[model samples]
Target: MTAAPTHASLDPSGFESRHFGIDDIFYSRTDGRGIILAANAVFQRVSVYDWSDLIGAPHNVIRHPDMPRGVFHLMWSILGDGKPFCGYIKNKAEDGSHYWVLAVACPLEDGFLSVRIKPGTEMFRQAQQIYTDLRHRERNENLPPEASSDALLQAFESAGYSDYASFMTKALTEETKHRDIALQRPADWRLRSILSIKEGVKEIEDHAGDVVRIFKQTNQIPYNMRLQAGRLEGTDGPISVISNNHRQMTQSLADAVATFSEKSLLGNDYLIQAEFLHGVSRVQHDLLQSFGLEPVIDGQDKAQEKALLSRQQMEFVSMAHKAVVEVSDRVSAFSKICNDVRRLKAGLEMTRVMCKIERSRIAERVDGLDEIVQQLGKAQTDLDHLLSKMDGAVQQILEAAERLTQSRQRAA
Candidate 1:
């Protein structure tokens, strides 16, 4: 039988220098206008560039040819804005060998401060392969350079999605599962679960606010257009062009609802979710215009409780934010509980399997206490679903916020 791999086995530290692992630091250099000044031994070993050869070359020289141009383009964009940036990068060595690095690069007094850790996890490795393939395809098509992060997302939708939100939802779900998902019991699982659900809903609401901010900041496609054209030719058109793609609207309301369900299961407070939500809603609003489906906020009710509802919603948002901060404080506590529960269940399952393996078919009735464990799993699933529903409802509130913003803008 194959043995379970140890953490050390899964992660190699051979790249460490005499003092630290190779992954401890990939490179430590100062560059002048993207040209390298000095590099560490580990950097030379992994990048396959000799100290002499790397000292004068552009940083892009080590950028893997297969890596997506969009990422580098984004990095440059950040630098132009005088902002530090970080991302997962795949760099090629002098010998054509590839390595993955979780890299952070930022401008310094003279040049830049760059730090990287070698990452060989399956998630990053697979992403590297995917990026490489995408790059190759771009080369063959002779299309502009490559898609912008947003445009790449649009490409996913253009292949078939009503908006970027649906695409991002699907992508995030896939990414989460690829990374590995685990659940646990709560000391106050029920209460914490409820709080978590509220937080998830609030996160959706917050994302809406962010989307509005982004739209306000960059409504003109001209700037992004120039970036897209310079890199990904032919994709510099208005948002209308991509939003109107027939394939983009293939995703239905039902699909969006399901995405909310899956995403709400783990946690919330996504950094990019507002962007995704804004993108999706934009598509939906555009489609409604095209198809002549009257867009409605569904707020026609004139009950006296309207004021109360508004106040309650605001209170909920505030309370949810507080809960989110608390959850962050005790982050991973719930997951640890889940890990304990999972381990216990696995132990029980092993006993049952061993019995079958040995042909000892006597089922030991541990029902007296075993029932509780089973109940916990069911509770976990139910909590997950509840969190999901809350997320959807909260997302609706975000939609309302968006509408409110648009209305105010029009009035102004």
Candidate 2:
């Protein structure tokens, strides 16, 4: 590995770069280990490097010194696994000029494809400051790239990013939003839907946490009934049998609820994966719409480039569509779960009805018997209320995923 560049070595005093318009997008395709394979005209223009110097060259030929080694370490770690990565990157030109871009890197069959836009958002400034601080720390503490990468993630957590996945998606979404405003363009609905899906999935995950508590509360009804049964009559009486049956049914229902919670969590992961690919497709689609249509020396090269770019974008889009469908199926599973829970709720209602009947039949008075029946009534009421809300949320998610799926199909 190249020795980590020190802050002094990467000082901005030497930065001399050309500014590209916010509309300008830089594109490059590189091999697995960062060897450059192809590039767009804008990238060639900004880097001040010809096709001869860029093609087959290590991508680091343009890597800005001011960029902390930690960023690249984190970047390659994700990209190495054929995953997509989005972050702000500063690149150096052949004559040492520098320009910053919000870059999205996606893994390709042969290597990786990067699409970058000039960042107009305030987040770009934040990224610059973060990189400077990390580079300074690396120089002062003799930190390795991996250690500096850990520090960078800690810095992100301090800045309100829960993890790298959330941070990357939010950052890309922010940059895209700012770009639209800067260009005086309408909002990109594609990217907006991706964020909305992510938020919806998070809501589902939060609600899943309550399943255990809700199911556990119902267990108390049987226990309370059994206690009262012992006082009202000898053990193994009619009330005792009813309580035992309630326990068995509720136990099975509890197991089903547990599975629902697990599926909710798994669905949340699918949302993240879908959002990541959607973001990938968004940037590549931009390039396809603008870059491929522009003039190139030979129209054939442009066609070929657009074809490959479209293929990659569609590949992600296809996977994202599948994920959205999977999320929909998970929602359907939740519907079934809610139905199962409803059956248990019905059972509780019946048990309460039986208790009331028994109270009327008894000539001798029993203390707290009415209250236990009321408690059973309350549990059923709560379960009904919870199921209604959960079903509503599930419906909303299903509708949102359907819309998102339709958009993906159109984009494909």
Candidate 3:
């Protein structure tokens, strides 16, 4: 086995000579024994100590109090065996401010190579929970605080993370996709408004899948959309669109449902379809409301609109049927007038014949009656023709009603 490199023997002020010109990151190489063999200028800056002060010191000099030592112990186990290891780590800075990093560290024959990046918020939160638990165990067991790192590793293992590498992979992967970034309005709406709403729902479902995938990767607390209330504070986020648009769709569907007429069987079937649509709206509205958005349909407006629409539809149908009845009555009235004129004509004709044996004055009266009868005949014919056209109109209305009923039944 290769022996660990000796610590860099140098004066504090001469750090620039021993470790110089590394990249912007804090760079360091530590031997098998944890001795710092080399450090770049950035490392000196981060450690809050000059090169001379840091060179011979253990690499643990910058370790923050909140970091579990067991993580390092496990990290070393893999690296000491010439393997790569990665983890989320907390590192203290010269200014006492701490930063979280997702660290990838490797072991070489001579020393170790480490690289890191900023950790995600969710990762930091989970790490905090784990480290806190480790701290409690350390206190209860009276073990050295650093020894709690073992407890953390055990906890992670118990939770089924195969190793530090796997855990880090999951954490990094979880942070990769932002749910809202993947959302897009669906295409192929086919000019159907309802289909468009359905497409939006599909997009939301896809986003929800992303959320679930992230949770599987991290084992962290998954997002609860119902609980995310402040998502609209900025430019509208995905959740904001969902909440607002969903409410709008709900109100629209409710209004459409209310427009169905109650008297027509076909209209009633349309109402049933509307009810199904309304159910979808209700569920969506409830979800959005849970996230603190105002619903598009208020309680009173929904109730009043539904009742008013039903009443209006019934009134409209009743008025149409009443019109049919009024036309029939007009026909009957015209017939009665014709019948009275006919009777008068018959009486006048008889009187005129009898006048042949009497005066010509009675014959003149019969002539006047004949003219009245002629006008009544013309008027009766016109009225009858108008009544016949009205009957045809009534037939058309009934046919329309039948067709509408069939269509609604199919839709239902």
Per-candidate Cα RMSD to the true structure, in Å, reads 27.4, 4.6, 34.9
TM-score of 2: 0.85
Better of 2 and 3 by lDDT: 2
- For residues 287-382, write the lDDT of model 1, one tens digit per residue: 223222222212222232233223333433344334443433332333333333333334334332332332233245533223323433443344
The residue ranges of model 1 lying beyond 4 angstroms of the native Cα positions read 1-23, 146-151, 155-412
Predicted candidate 3 versus true structure: per-residue lDDT over 83-190, tens digit per residue: 556677766655555556556565656677554434444655566567656655555587663466567767777767765544654554343222112223233111
Per-residue alpha-carbon lDDT of model 2 for 337-407, expressed as tens digits? Answer: 66666676788888888888888888887766788787788776776766666777777777777787776
Candidate 3 CA-lDDT value: 0.43
Query: Scored by CA lDDT, what does every candidate get?
Result: 0.42, 0.78, 0.43
Model 3: how far residue 245 lies from native, Å: 61
**Which of 1 and 3 is ahead in TM-score?**
1
The residue pairs found clashing in candidate 3 are: 12-52, 70-149
In model 2, where is the ten-residue run with the lowest total lDDT?
Answer: 1-10
Please list the residue runs of candidate 3 whose C-alpha ends up more than 4 Å from where it truly belongs after superposition.
Answer: 1-24, 144-150, 157-163, 174-412
Backbone steric clashes in candidate 2, count: 1
Which one is best on TM-score? Answer: 2
Could you tell me the lDDT of residue 361 within candidate 1?
A: 30
